[model samples]
Target chain A: MISAYVTLAVLLLGLALWRQTQPDPGHRQIAAGGWRQMRPLLVRIPIALIAGSFLAMLVPRELVASSLGDGSGLQGILLATLLGAVMPGGPMITFPIALALISAGTGTAQMVTLITAWSVLALHRVIAFELPALGWRLTGIRLLACLILAPIAGLLAMLIGAART
Target chain B: MAGQTGGKPARNGPPLLDGSTVFFVLLALGAGLAVLLLRGADAFNTALADGLGLLLLIMPIVVAAVLVGAYVQAMVPREAMERWLGGSSGMRGLLLATAAGSLTPGGPFAAFPLVLALYRSGAAVPVCVTYLTSWSVLGINRALVWELPLLGPEFTLTRLLVSLPLPLIAGLLTRGLLHRFSRTVT
Candidate 1:
């Protein structure tokens, strides 16, 4: 974690320096914008962490492991995909739950499927944003195009995991 | 078109307290209550401490990520990219859209408008799908800020490697599907 912070700090410094070199002269605005973004994160992260931790405790380890464990295979991946698509909210909400599940012994492949499905096929995002913005034709096309990706990714992850172990 | 773009304010930054935040707070409270009831005060305290400890550990990384995201967004040549996206096609267009999607910062609100704008300006359906797919599956901002810190590097790397080809594949698939659909319709 400390290493992650250091790396990010160096990267942030580099980006800040690059901004300084830019002609826009809106470094102050950028900083303000960052803070504006951070405020919501600040409010949500702790609560999410709490929720995740509590969830981790409440959810039976045996249940998680049995359903989404390494041995669960394609069935687990499919279930995870469904879970991911229906899961509500953004990363702040999703990541914590993911972490909690990880702690509770969810398999790597299943988690990968879940995250990929959530990112690509999130029903809420499609309904709330894509349909309204892009209209049905494009939305339908994109959905049909990308529908198979999450499961494929999950299966591949499982293969890689198998190869590794 | 101008009105369509102008009417929806670009929600680059989320509001401080939105519906999601309220929902999360309620979820946390309910979970906390459940823990307290099911186990006891001891377990409740432990869970709280664990959550707070995790928060403190990741806080600096999160802060750095937020700044990096903001600075990168500020620095992106949006108009130049739009111009590039507007006048490209074929495999090159798909590649460009994929790159743009991966690089695009912020949530759906910021991305969808740009995609819609690009689509309106005659970007190919495959290209648009590629861009949106790339944005959805491989966004650098989300990966850096959320995935790396929360999920750890191994999972992130594995997931990314598996997903790297997805946007292009989706683009190509969309191309084929659209062609067949057009033929059927005609």
Candidate 2:
């Protein structure tokens, strides 16, 4: 994980630098904009993760494993997907909770479904961003198309042994 | 348009940290405080330390992710989006939109408005749906910067591979609906 993280940073930094060489006015904006994004994140992500980690310890492992565990099977995946979709906020919020769940003995399939649900069907994103941007018709259309993604991804994870995370 | 782009518009509306940010902070603080009180300080410390460990693992990657987000925003030809993502351009256009949505960084704030602009400028419903579906499913920036680090490569790869067909499927389904609805209207 550390190696992968380092490699990504180095590679992305290279890309940002290469982009900077183009002399476009937007180049300077990248660093400045990046700092702006990071400011809130540096504060928010830690708070979320720190709280989540402790919360995970408090959650009974047996309970979590029983519900979202491999033993729970398809039912667990469905529950996870539903939970994830209804849960608000972006990746910073979701990922930390997910990490806590993983530490709490949640199965890979359930986690996969959870994250997929968050990405595709998150109520907040749809209500806040999608509706305002694309209107009801388009929003409904996209939602309909995405309705099956999470459950199917769960099933696929089971079939392909992606449950090993 | 969100009034965010095309030269910073007047700051007449609410700030970014109004409702959502406050709620999240309250939730976190409440949770942290609850665990500390119930579990005692030692357990609370342990939990935070564990979180710190995980945070350390992913901090650099997260930083890089933010930078990538900014770079993608800086570089995209947001104004010309309609030219490529719009009209009766067919499959090529759909593919371009999908690629842009998945590969392009930034959060909903960046992607949705650009998509809405394209739609307003005459992008087909199918094309727009394809773009949104791709962004949700593929989500390259989040997957790379967050998922890989937090969830690791295996789960991420598996999800990515399984989800590979989603955008095209969504496009086709949406296109089918569009045609059927138009037929009904006619």
Candidate 3:
């Protein structure tokens, strides 16, 4: 974790240096914009974390282990994919829930499927953004084309995990 | 498309205290109450401390991610990206779209419009599909900001490796579907 922080800090410094080299440096505006984007996330993050912690406690570990843990296999992946597709909101919500689930002993492959499905097949996003922006034809085609990807990713992760062990 | 803002706050941008935030706050409160009542004070305190501890651990990383996302947004030449994607087709087009998608920062609001613009400007269907797939699946900004921090390196790396080929496969499948549909229409 300390190493992660150091690496990120170094990357941030490099980005700052790069920004300075630009001819029309709009550092102030960029900083303000970033703050604007981040403000909402700041509010959400703590609450989400607290909620996740409580959830991790409340949820039965035996259930999580039996359903989504190692050896859960295709059934777990499929269930995760379905849950992910229906999950609303953004990374703030999704990641916290994922963390909670992980804490409760959900398998790595299951979480992979869940995140991938949320990213790729989120029904809310498709309806709220994609359909309005890209219309039915493009959205429908894209949805169809990418429908199976989350499960495939989960299966692959499962295979890799099996191989490693 | 050239003058369009990539990550700038739109005129009608969401309020700081939006519906989602309110909902989450309520949910968190409810959960806290439940923990206090059912699990007792000790459990509640423990959970709260754990949450705060995790928050402290990841806060710096999150800040860095936000800064990186912001700077990358400022730096990306949106017009250049549009031009490159607009002029390409076939496998090369899919590759370019994938790169653009991964590199394109911001959320659905920023990305969906770009894909829409590309589609309207005559970028092929497959290319558009690939771009959106890449944005949704392989987004570098999201990986750095959320996935790596939350999921850790091992899970992040494994998921990434498995997801690497997804956009291309989706593009190819889309192209095939389009071909079949077009033939039937004709």
Candidate 4:
């Protein structure tokens, strides 16, 4: 599935690149801009990989399985959301940890809630990016409005999980 | 495409790799070392190899996505984009901003600054909120490329369907609140 996803992304990107290259100005600018942004990956990628690996190894699998496993139910959703918000790092870190929990018997709803919480209220993103760029008022209101989203998502997924059984 | 801001980089008061990154890295290292000491090197090596495999898998996607993102961004410079998003009002602006946020694929560094640019140029509070919320929730590229592959299609769809209403609701509420705040202050 991942391979298919990657292939699709690459194909679409190829089409976009081709379209951009059609115009001479875009051709010149796109290459330079892409390189500039992609350059940091030289450093960030390795660090991220190492961090992700270590985080995966360190995650308390027993606790995760027990707290977010099939039997955990509604309370599990809240716990997962809270964990997502506080868990540090980007997708490189989060996804692996989520995957580990899944393998350890955590429910799909718990993982969904976890990722949703991470996406909307990630402490790392807020500290590293949002606070400085968007500021207190914008961040605060956004957070407030987003308060119920993870739980809502969790509930929906849980309903689905229940229906399937 | 992540760090492509204009002029001074949104002065955010702190350096890019602040204490957060260092602190987290240290934490990972400490935990990993303990795991190694207790669980032995085989478990440690296996975990690292898994991370390496994942990195390899996503490397091509990441580069291609970045290039595509840069092209999209180039096609709509901040000045032009900000003008459009800021001038547009009501549901249309909200929808457009949400679409932009959903379609736009880049890391946090690129997005936060861009939204700030829109806000600084007079985009409505609701539009900005919508944009951020949509970006966080929908993140189409991330979901399709990363989540779908990692978690499978079913899981991805479940989450998306559940999160569908988030941006619009957040936007409407934020707009109303902002209007009330300004009206009262004046």
**Candidate whose DockQ is highest:** 1
What is model 2's interface RMSD?
A: 3.7
Deviation in Å, model 1, residue A132 alpha carbon: 1.7
In candidate 1, what fraction of native interface contacts survive? 0.89
Q: Lowest summed lDDT over 10 consecutive residues: which window, candidate 1 chain A?
A: A1-10
Which structure among the candidates has the greatest lDDT? 1
- When 3 and 4 are scored with lDDT, the better candidate is 3
CA lDDT of A15 in candidate 1?
87
Which of candidates 2 and 4 reaches a greater lDDT?
2
Model 3 alpha-carbon miss at residue A58, Å: 1.7
DockQ of 1: 0.63
**Tens-digit lDDT track of model 2 for B86-120:** 65547887787777768756689878987877777
Off by over 4 Å in 1: B1-14, B184-186
lDDT computed for candidate 1:
0.85
Candidate 3: pairs in clash: none
Pairs that collide, model 2: none
Give lDDT tens digits, candidate 1, residues B1-186.
011123323355357567787788898899999999998999999999998988888777777788888887777668867875776678888888888888898899999999998888878888889988898888988888788778876788789888888899999999999988898632
Q: Is the docking of candidate 4 incorrect, acceptable, medium or high quality?
A: acceptable
Score every model by TM-score: 0.90, 0.84, 0.90, 0.76
TM-score per candidate for chain A alone: 0.88, 0.82, 0.88, 0.70
Better of 1 and 4 by DockQ: 1
lDDT (Cα, tens digit) per residue for candidate 4, span A55-135: 666668788778898778889999988998998877756765676567667888888899999998998889889998888
Model 4 lDDT per residue over B1-186, tens place: 345445534335343344545565675677678769988999888877876787776666666655655666666665655665776767888878777787766779768888888888777788888888889989875775456545666788889888887788888878767776678632
lDDT of each: 0.85, 0.76, 0.84, 0.74
For residues A1-165, what per-residue lDDT tens digits would candidate 2 score against the true structure?
A: 766666577767787777868878565566787776665566666666776786686777898999998778989988998998898888767876787888889988888889888888999998988887778888887888777788888888887884443
Retained true contacts (fraction), each candidate: 0.89, 0.66, 0.72, 0.55
DockQ of each: 0.63, 0.53, 0.59, 0.48
